[model samples]
Target: MTTELSVILAGGGTAGHVSPLLAIGDALRAAAPGVEITALGTADGLEARLVPAAGYRLETINKVPFPRRPNAAMFSFPFKFKAAIDQAKAILTEAKADAVVGVGGYVCTPVYLAANKLGIPVFIHEANARAGLANKLGARKAAGIGVAYASSGLAGARVVGMPMRKSIAAMDTAALRPAARAALGLDEHTPVLVVTGGSSGAASINRAVSASLPAIAEAGVQVLHITGAGKGITDASGALLAGAGYRQVEYVDGMQNAYAAADLIVARSGAGTVCELAVAGVPSVLVPLPIGNGEQKLNAADLVGAGGAVLIDDAGFTPEYFATEVLPLLANAPALAAMSAAARAQGRNDAAEAMAAMVLEGTKQQSTGRHPKMGS
Candidate 1:
């Protein structure tokens, strides 16, 4: 049975949604040479730039965000939503898709519904521990669902973990450590701490860490702080902090080096970062962003509960707390090693492959000529 498979991956809005979509696309292409993969996103989302940049054909639909409150937008929601669904249906019809794999975002809901209506199988990947609204809706009719965390609360969702990009999924920390350290101008013996709040940096983490820089330096550990673009914070030298193993860059082209050189990580618990840290076997102190639906808190729960990382409230993650909690943790070699081991144990390195298999299995079922309707 050499039926060619065409899969449409629907997700966008942020890196959390788009990253996994790209990962699965990469997996499908690698695992099956002839598979046709297309991405469904909105022009307003990060996916507009990222999806095409990743070398996948991106078919955009209107951004049809669900109205949370009763208002004018809510009243017009039906017409706009139907238009988006029609757009998605057109793309699927042209691609002749066998299945849809939705990662969840503003664009995913319409695509999922359209695929279901067309009798095409739909699979889902819920990246956050707390499932997003689009994914929650998509899961009801998804032929199979893969969740990043066990606590995602999606019925019939299997814990297939977060689908990471190839570089991260294949990284060997020990092998990359020396070069990573050298590139950062760090000494081999000095422990390194990497701080980041994703690509856009977090103000709270930046302020706390910047204020505690001297104290952090006093602990005999080096630091690689990614301050994010436009954060406007600098070092004692009035630069972006480059002095004696305490380097701060607005961004790094590749995070492989950062992860390779890190003995401990101080960052927000975004689903992507959490999964990357676990896969790389890096210990972390997670200070979840205190906003939205507390998804960041949930994102850190698996690693925190497994003793792989520590969770701190954002309000309490001050310079004082860093001095008391982080500095001491840095000095403890055994604890760091144990935490690294635990993180590795929780890592699902083969998540992309697993998710790819699920997608293919759903496609295979679709080929059986008797498509089982997903939901009653």
Candidate 2:
């Protein structure tokens, strides 16, 4: 008798977490044809909108973050956590999930514990080089683990790379360069530099890039600067520089065009951004966010160490850095070509398929009462 397969993807809050969860969901659906996939998230997270928009059922749970320090919230943490676990267990039962796939977020904590309590296996995917609290806790009981970077420090974590969207995964920069450039109102034969800071813009990057835009334009390269929503031009904090061949926008919905048209990219070193840049084969200067556990630094290490990209500290990412380092790189065709090649070599476009297969394999093993495979 064939056992019907069902899955619960527990991840949310940020796009970094939600995107991978959706990719895995898409992969499982494609691979199994009739697998029932449910997403466990919070109503406030991006997942609430993204998950349902992706055509998957989303079950929301309470947002009970793990406290780090002594506080009243910390004192009440156990009760809140228990409540989340109870809610997760109910969702898991309703979905009749065969496996719980966690992409790393607060929602995963309870889902992981609940799945383990129910004797159902958990699969984890860590998107950062520095593992988060949720993934660290989930890893202990997880049947299998996948990491985006080799140095993620999760025991038995296999480097699966980041699961990128289909548009980015299938993009051919050279073949689509002309059309992409046209779509962005860029000139053919002109090198285009696309600068962005993900969904929420980075102030440091914006200020530095904006200040250096005039000089950058003098270098004969066009700039596509996406300042992000709510961080528009005319802001006192970070103003835009108006110049010929300089295009500024708050956001771009279809980033494939931006990536395709770009000869070089300037952005933060978020795991998703790093992976997307590598897969798109666009050379970049990565500035890791100054906050957090320096995961962005580790996320960009593979490409930077491979000579595909450059790393600059947030403090050092100044207008002078842009003029002195970035402008010259834009002028050097051979160096740019080499960097692009290195980025492509470092990227894995089949990561989604590989991760999907791993989840299914782990599920099958769990059902058969056999030991799941471990290690990279």
Candidate 3:
């Protein structure tokens, strides 16, 4: 009798990690009908909700963050980290996990250590152009390492691309354009620009879009502005701002429709956003968040290099920039088409399946008493 293949997907905290985790889970299930998939995350992380909502069991552990400097937490870090590792080991043992796939988050370190201790194969996927500390440590002994960017800095990592939602990955933009425009109440004949700052929203992008609404309308462009939740643009009296051809919503549950309806996108250069835009063949103006370790800029490199996107720094993505750069680009159909083609060329919709295959293959090798090659 063939025993079922059991796998543990580790990572959480943010949508960036959880999104890819869920995608890999779905792909694994698709590839192996009887595979058992469980997710490891903290109760407070987004995975606590998204993982279960996606129909996979989630195992919770206390978040153990590595302190950057000497502090109280750093002093107690050893005990906390050990406890988390024990919890992970218990979960993995109970699940009989044949392999662990991590997408990179605070939760991954303990899980990686636990899997290593238990002698289970570990597969890692790094979503950022620059490797996160957790992933950098986990990659040391990972049986397979997959990265969304060529410059991820994980030694021996394969560029498998970001594992994205099926809604965006399997989207046929051209076929869905008309219905998507109608659904969003946008005119099919007019150029449509979709603006978003992700779920929590980007204050800078929101401010710039609000300031450029009149210019956007004057350029015969319809705007679908997804202001991050509760971050809607308002006027002096606190009335929500409105323009001739602009539609505002606090959030969009699924982005496929928005991508289909968009002739152009102006948004942050998050790893997920960059990959999704490329997959959907949507041209974009990417404004890297002017903070953090500059990973957002690194994440935008491939798409920008591919000529699918134009990168603008956050400070420069103002109303003046929009008028001089975006409006002119909106009027140029040929440029948009070329950008779309370039974006598509850089897309890898098969990333989830590719990662899934690696996990299963590594698991099979472990079961056969044969070691899988690293980075294979």
User: Cα RMSDs of all predictions?
Assistant: 4.3, 4.4, 3.9
What TM-score number comes out for model 2?
A: 0.92
| lDDT score, candidate 1, position 223 | 78
Q: Which stretches of candidate 2 lie over 4 Å from their true place?
A: 235-242, 368-376
lDDT, candidate 2, 139-231, per-residue tens: 998899988887888999898889877888888989989999898889989888888987778999888987885787689889888988778
- Candidate 1 residue lDDT tens string, 61-129: 999778888888998999999999999999999888888999988888899899988998899999898
TM-score-superior candidate, 2 or 3: 3
- Best by the lDDT measure: 3
TM-score each candidate.
0.90, 0.92, 0.92
Number of the top-ranking candidate, with TM-score as the measure: 3
- Could you tell me which residue pairs clash in candidate 2? none
Give the clash total for candidate 1: 0
Candidate 2 C-alpha error for residue 43, in Å: 1.8
**Model 1 vs. true fold: TM:** 0.90
Instruction: Give the per-residue lDDT digits (tens) of candidate 3, residues 1-376.
Output: 3577778999998777888899999999999988888999999887887888889999999999899888889989999999999999999998888899999889999999999999988999999999999899999999999999888899999999999868789999999999999998889999988999987789998988899877877887788999987798898889899888788988876688999999999988889889999999999999998987899999999899989999999999989998889889988999999999999999989899999999988788776433222331
Query: Which ranges in model 3 have alpha carbons more than 4 Å from their true place?
Result: 368-376
